[model samples]
Target chain A: MVVDIAPMIVLGMVILTSLAFDFTNGFHDTANAMATSIATGALKPKAAVSLSAILNLVGAFLSVEVALTVTNSVIKIQDSTGAPNPALTADGGSALLLIVLSGLIGAILWNLLTWLLGLPSSSSHALFGGLIGATIAGLGFSAVKWVGTGAKLDGVVGKVILPALLSPVIASLVAMTGTWLIYRITKTVAEKFRNDGFRWGQIGSASLISLAHGMNDAQKTMGIITLALIASGQWHDLTAVPLWVKGACAMAIAMGTYIGGWRIIRTLGKGLVEIDSPQGLAADSASAATIIVSSHLGFALSTTHVATGSIIGTGLGRKGASVRWGVALRMLVAWLITLPSAALVAALTWGIGHLVGGLAGAFVVFAILLVAAGYMLWHSRKNPVGHHNVTDEWEASPEGLAPELPKEVVR
Target chain B: MSQILLALQAAGQVLLAAVILGAGLPAMFSLGMRALAYGNGGSAEVEVEAQPHVLGKVLAYICFGVVIIAVMLGISWIVGTGMGYKLSFEHFLPVFRKK
Candidate 1:
């Protein structure tokens, strides 16, 4: 009885933590799809998030492919067919459960910290980073799939690092060309007429991005939860995610989208460039195309990186518009550190959990995550960036990198 | 080194596809809008005394039709992939195949 209850408690923590990561993934990425639309007044602040939320829910249901092998790219916990390694499944899978829990804590903490800082870091990278860190702590470094075997692009370098380096540059070039072409094509059209036409274009392209986000991002969480279930010997199927897991993930992400990450939206929208409707359309179309094409080609890329690159590219394409290099540089720095920072945190969490041992260790890790998350939430309240002030005029700060913090609202 | 080479090949493919669909589609949309402005004339264009042209309207509709078709293809691609089908082109005609 004691043995059974310990695994159950650990399994419960894994499910909850995976859901929490999914929620963050949703809000963290809302800006990727809707920031340009909101920035250009193509959609109202509240309406943009609401539409994205609905589209995300629909997109979540659209994914029929089993992403159960998601962990194969970064770590060696699962075999090629998405089955948990039998060695790790010992002691009712308590070992696998602890690594997953600590990794999730690392991811969540990094995500919340970035959110509070108004930085648009990749949630996927954070997740990979956390997992990699915890895996190093739990298993030896040899267990990590650093590079793919043969000619295949399979491991961390191929899937994560290479894509991170290249996707943005590709997206930027595509967007720059699109922006320049649109401006050249519509040079004779009246500005007001051009803006009106592209507003509809922006909304359409943005919706495509939201749908893609739901289809792709939701699968990652579903994969994690299903892996947890399989490890604990509760689920047997290695191909299909449980329906309840799918539904719960869909709801969590949609709810996060509706809540909106206004701070990141403001930064991507106003901080990167003074986006007009035509540029918004160009940027979003570029993002939508890059994401779709990459995923189709099986060269997975982060939506956030593509979107940011597109926005900056638009700034470069426009004749007089200038990109805030300072802001762009800061974002670049954030991206560089996201993987390592999350890894460090996760490694630390795993160390602490390993020290305490068993169910108590899992609880200790969970408590630390709760405390860190609560503190970040409290810190964010100090300079809240909500729908009310999300699109306030961009003021360059002397300190640099930090967008001007929203002015305190007196009730 | 093989991984780097493979990643580059994939990146090149993505960039090519992205330019055609992402950049090219928006340019087509802009062209449609430009043609519409020519068709409407008057306040739609920078020229104050321009006349609406019937040919411009026809051209505008043609451009918009192509864009609508592309968007439809995109939607179908999303739906088909969700259902575990891959969108492929055989002799320039889009076909769905079981993946």
Candidate 2:
């Protein structure tokens, strides 16, 4: 019974950490769905987030292809080498639980850090990176299916990395063309006329994008929790996601969305581009299409990248509007770092958790996670970004160079 | 590299489809606005905020109707396939699956 108790406790901790990761994912990506609508005043900030939250709840029921991809791609649930199992696995199911717990811990911290910096990195990649890092620390390179099954490159490279590169490009192209066409077609119309009509269109497109986001992102948490169940010896196969799991994940994400990630919204909506109604509509349309289509293709593309790219594309499509390459460069750097940084943290947490042993180790790491999260929360208070002040003027360096920066680089 | 090519091909399909539906819907809405200008079949100089001509109003409704249908199809596709039993396909969109 004592032997069973430790694994049970670790499993419970893993569930909670997975939920925490889902919560961060909620707030982090809300901007992907609603930022443009809010920026253009098509939807009030509170109403925008509230609508996104409800749609995300409805969207969670959309599909399981991504979840299946995550489970099969990231970690080997059962070894097939015909060799003796490790002592940890042989002793009990605790080893798998520990890996997942450490991975979720890593993902949650990365989510918090990126959220603090207001950088909209890929939460999907963060989650995958955490799992990969923890698997590496726990089991070695052989455990990860790098080249994928049957000598094809359809695993992480096919699903996560390649899609990451292509999604933003596709979104940008679509958005740019959309913006140019909208402008050209409506050039004869009054500015107020076109702008007013597009505002209502922007709301619809933004809502669809939010629904698409829910369909894509909430599935990640579901996959991780399913992994937990399998690793804990509760579920035997990578099967259908149970109903209760779906409800819990959907609710967690909706709650988080309602809370809203105002800082990141400010970054995407205001900092990246001074979005007009048409640009907002174009961006949202691009995001909805890219996300929906990518998920349909079984690729876990980050909605953040798509939204950012669409915003940039709109700026480029319009005459005399400048893309803030400095901010864009910063965002790119953050995206590059997201996977490895999350992995490093996951690895360290995994090592620390094991060194102390059993439930106590998981508890210690959870406490550390709470402290790290709390500190980030407090640190953000100093900057104080919210719906009220999210539309304030963008300072290129946050240092406010006093009206000299725009002529410094922009055309 | 072949895997990369395969992924690229799928991306091309996504781009095309997105353009037709994603970008196209907003363009339809724009066209709807434009069509509303000729409700009286006069010059296309009617102010957008002004009252619309009946024929132009019907044309606007047709454009919006196409947009609504597209959105509904997208949702049903998500719902039918996402619940994991209504449809199955080896790639992208799905073919009907019984049970």
Candidate 3:
């Protein structure tokens, strides 16, 4: 019972799945950049999302260097035989499509669940985790190009994790210095002028952070889609991305941005720290600088991690700022689990696909996904979360609606 | 000429299926948000305090669904046709098998 599908049909499926992942990526990560501004009242929620969406579209057109990293730098496209394998190329088999679609399902489910619980997890990590898990299940451990994975790890550690760990420390020091100088220089200036100026500065800085987010995060989906093509053997190499691929990924993410990830917004904006104008400005500037530099260096860092670190730094910099350790701890736990969890789901889906063959397998996987999604939607209706209650009030604990104070109080 | 025609029909089928699947999930999410924003049953005091711009949010969701499906279908049509194939939804499942 062999199934004979045309190469073009397979190619089309790959493109569609990539767009689906891209759309999910947009909605999932929107909270990373705009949550703080929206939370602090620095930017209206609608305006913040609109700005992020536009910048994300612009950023998608700027480069494909990161796309190369995902297509060739992460997974071993060639089999152990090392022959001219079409499956390893950009237009060969439908397996790549299956892998990508399953991975997306895993990541999207994780994102929706976390959002429902009002947790701020790293969407970037979730996607990566899903891909790795699915890839492992589809192909064995040998299929993982360790060298490529190592290179990505080096970039993640040096460019992403290290900076994430240190950015807050640096930001805190910089903010402390900036605040002291601001106070010293503006001793004679009216309080109104000083506060107002910083408030405007925060807006500009926040916008920059959103732009940097567009440049780094959106490119990831582009890479994954391109990788699917390359793995399928449709395209020969990491050539120019088709205009449709670029446009679809950009628009999908932008639309997701417009929809907004309101749950994470509260966790980031008001849950982590009470952000004032000056602190918000300082943090936004630092995050923007870090993300842009890394993007230029071709490292894909999690914008969520960088933004969270910056906001924490800003909180620490201020004398009386309240940093909520309990919420922060919860967010960190989600981060730790996202990659492995998504991978496990991907592995299970791949196993199921293997049990069935060709179109039947694909249909079975799709049907199961629909059922799971339906169940999730039904469960969500039991306790709905939307824009009106998408704030800290929804996360209100027994103590009160406000986030609990940090264990080590700053003031 | 026959080969080109077949390719065009195949591409159209693929494009249509892609659009429906790609846009369906987001539409569901958007509708979910709208229902939560406008649904009755909460205490009057809570409802009064929690009024969101329901019409605006629903409109945004509709526009989002339309735009995404349009873009996906449009791109598939242009790319498929430009590459010498016609885009359609029927190609979502392989109809022609090599004998």
Ranking by lDDT: 1, 2, 3
Question: Rank by TM-score, descending?
Answer: 1, 2, 3
Residue-level lDDT tens digits of model 1 in B7-56 = 99999999999999999999999999999999999999999689999888
lDDT of 2 by residue, A1-411 (tens): 345677777778888888888888989999998988988888889889999999988887664553543545655644442111344454346787788788888889988887777778888888888888888888887777675544343667777777778888888898898888887777666666667878888888888887887877888788777766665566655556777888888888888898998878888888778889998998888888877877676555788888888998888888777888877877887788788888889999889888987788889888888999999899777666788867677774364211122232222
TM-score, model 1 to reference: 0.96
* Interface RMSD, per-candidate values to 1 decimal: 0.7, 3.2, 21.6
The candidate maximizing TM-score is 1
Order of the predicted models by DockQ, top scorer first: 1, 2, 3
Tell me which residue pairs clash in candidate 2.
A62-B82, A63-B82, B39-B53
lDDT of 3 by residue, B34-85 (tens): 3333432122112345444556456545744653455345333323432335
lDDT of 3 by residue, A34-105 (tens): 776776667777888888888677666554444445523334554332222365344356676777767776
Residue A390 alpha-carbon offset, candidate 2, angstroms: 1.3
- Of 2 and 3, the candidate ahead on TM-score is 2
Output the lDDT of residue B11, model 3: 30
lDDT of 2: 0.77
In model 3, where do residues sit more than 4 Å from their true spots?
A: A1-3, A6-13, A64-66, A78-91, A145-192, A381-386, A389-411, B1-99
**Model number with the top lDDT:** 1
The list of candidate 2 runs beyond 4 A from truth reads A1-3, A62-69, A78-91, A149-153, A236-238, A395-411, B38-52, B85-99
lDDT of 1 by residue, A1-411 (tens): 445689999999999999999999999999999999999999999999999999999998898885999989999999989999999999879889988898889999989988887889999999999999999999989988999878778889999999999999999999999999999999999999889999999999999999999999998999999999999999999889999999999998998998998889988999889999999999999999999999999998899999999999999999999999978977898899888889889999999999999999999999999999999899788778888888877784422334443333100
Clash count for each candidate, listed in order shown: 0, 3, 23
